[model samples]
Every structure is written in structure tokens, then in C-alpha cells.
Target: MEGKRVMAITGVHHAQITIPRGAEEQGRQYYCHLLGLPEIEKPESLKGRGGFWLQVGDRQVHVGTEDGVERSSTKAHLAYHVTDIMAWRQRLQEHGFQILDGVPIPGYERFETRDPFGNRLEFIQPLA
Candidate 1:
């Protein structure tokens, strides 16, 4: 409380999600090939642990490998802001990713869905 100053928080640098062990290729196919997020090389030290990183806009998403945990049935999730809410809904639905409607928020249109691994994801677009 004295002369100390509080540090201001900045934007997110990265977020992490997990997949079943030895399923990195599947993750890559869904996240990269289908979703269009570019794959970025993993750091040398973190390579042996499995999984890889992807570039989402200016931020990064790290997909890790783990097992036995319930990837679904959790509230923890990542929400990505997009330009077209309807198009994203259609595209993901075409691939059979079930669409879950998000709660109504004033001035926004959004929806939720799961990745192939069952990680909850939200896609939102601002309504002007």
C-alpha cells in the first residue's frame, strides 16, 4: 500500500487445451486443416511431451496431450471472436460438431460448440 504500484494486466498470450495421448495428428487435422489455425513449431524443450501449438490471430493456442480426464462436462473453455457468427455455425455444423446456443448477451451474437476432443469453445461476433 505504500510506494508500490499495481501492475496492469495485458491481453492473453496463449491458452492451452488437452487431447488424448498419441492423438496429436487428429488435433492438428481439426484445428489446422479444418479450423484454419496455422501450426507453429513447438519449442525444442517441450517437443517430447507431445501435442503442438497453433496461432490464433495474434495469440497462440497450445494443444497438449493427456489422458483419462473428462475433456467434456466442464465449464472452462476458450472463446474466439470471429467476424461471422452464422457462417461459423454453418461450417462447424457441416462437419457435425453439435452447436450449443450461448446465452443471450446484448449487442452480441454467439454460440458454443465442442472440438473433436470435446473441449468447449465459443464463437462470438459483435452486433453493431
Candidate 2:
């Protein structure tokens, strides 16, 4: 116990997902306009770079710009806790986003989808 450092992670401050270079506007349209996430100003020091941030609940989601990576093939993703899953499904579908079913979990009902940039995302709701 003398040399061991105990690490306790309290909560997530933010999660970042990447989109291709120069696709920031499409990212904004899909995430902010279509998905209805509110945009937050990036710090002035970070503003010169491409991409933006979004506000989700009490957390910030950094949407960064990257190039040369295959976004669709990655299994990594962000899971957003949401209410009224059906409404969200309908809303995204109306905007031409496909709803993909995920594997069942014990106490959660969830589905997956891709942003226009092909970043994987999950919308999850707790079951009663």
C-alpha cells in the first residue's frame, strides 16, 4: 500500500469525436441543426484549428478535425443518455439518418447511428 496510487475517476468532463478535414460545416449542420446540440465557443487559443464543441447535459463534446483515418470502421464511440428514445429515433430518421440496433444490455435500451461524418454514436435510455 505504500507505493500504490489510488485512482478514482469521478465523472467525464467531455468526449471527443473526429470528422474529416474541412467538414466542419457539415458537422455543424448534422450535430447542431439536425441533432439539436447547442454549440459552445471553443477557447480562443484553440479557435484557429478546425472543428467545434457541443454542449450535452453538463458535459462538453469536442468535435475535432482530423484526416486520413477511417472513421466508419472504428468500434469506439460516445454513448449519450437520453429520454424518449422513440422520439429521437423518429427525429433522426426524418433527417435521413439510419437507426442501427445495438446488442441488448441488462437494464438499458439503446440504439446506434452514425453522424454524417461516420462517427459512431449511441443513444441510450434506462429501462424501468
Candidate 3:
């Protein structure tokens, strides 16, 4: 292995979350209007499937539509890093969304919430 090279891994390019059928508008309202993430266009080949793509900083969150699926917010979730934790928490509360407290993780403040379609999401801010 002296001359072997290991593959260099970079940051996440995108993460995909599923939404139930006919929930596109609700998804847009939450991910775009509330979260302030700009909606991006999907590839021409994939446009037939109903969904939305959103830009989160340098990364992307792809919300895809699935039919006939029961929605449940589980432990598996996507976590986004943010700057102001309290402000985000307030916003969620003001919007009538339930904020689930997260276990204390040193150097980070975090909370969990569910999207309109019951997709679990987490927001975190680094503590100095």
C-alpha cells in the first residue's frame, strides 16, 4: 500500500427527502418561504416526477414525491447547520410547528422539527 492512493472524499452535494403525493405546495411553502431556500430546477429528464429542489447554502435538498406512502417522522432525518438557533426555534414555534429538543451535544445547539409531510429535519448552530 505504499504507492496506493486513497480516494478523497468531499462534502455532501445533495440530500433527498420524500414527500407524499399532492403535498408539493406545502413543501414549497416550508422549504422556500419559511426556510428561505431558493427553489432550483430539476433535470429535464426528471421533471415528470412531481417534486421540488431547494438550495441550502452550497448544498442541495431534493424533495421528491412518492405515491401511496404513509408519512412518519422518524429518527432518520436531515440536519442543516444554521447561524441563529433561537431565531429559528422562534420561527418554527410561530409557524405552529412543534420543536423537539435534542440531546445536548457539546459545541452545538440543535432542535428537531417535522416538515408538512412528516419528514424529520434538524437544525443546528455551532456554539463558541
Candidate 2 off by > 4 Å: 1-7
Superposition TM-score, candidate 3 onto the true structure: 0.89
- In model 3, the worst 10-residue window by lDDT is 67-76
- Point out the higher-scoring one by TM-score: 1 or 2: 1
In model 1, pairs of residues that clash are none
lDDT of 1 by residue, 10-125 (tens): 88899999999999999988999988899999989999999999999899999999999797989899998999789999999999999999899999999999999889999999
After superposition on all CA atoms, how large is the RMSD of candidate 1?
2.0
Error of 1 at 125 (Å): 0.4
Superposed by TM-score, candidate 3 places the C-alpha of residue 14 at a distance from the truth, in angstroms, of: 0.8
Q: After superposition, how far is residue 48 of candidate 1 from its true place, in Å?
A: 0.6
lDDT of 1 at 109: 96
Sort every candidate by TM-score, greatest first. 1, 2, 3
Worst 10 residues of 2 by lDDT: 1-10
For all predicted structures, in order, the TM-scores are: 0.92, 0.90, 0.89
Candidate 3 lDDT, tens digit per residue, 1-128? Answer: 48887898777899999898778998899999999999999999998899989888889999999976555626789998998899999999999999999998998999999887888889999997
lDDT tens digits, residues 1-128, model 2? 58988899999899999999899999999889987899999999999898999999999999999999888999999998999999999998998889999999999999999988788999999998
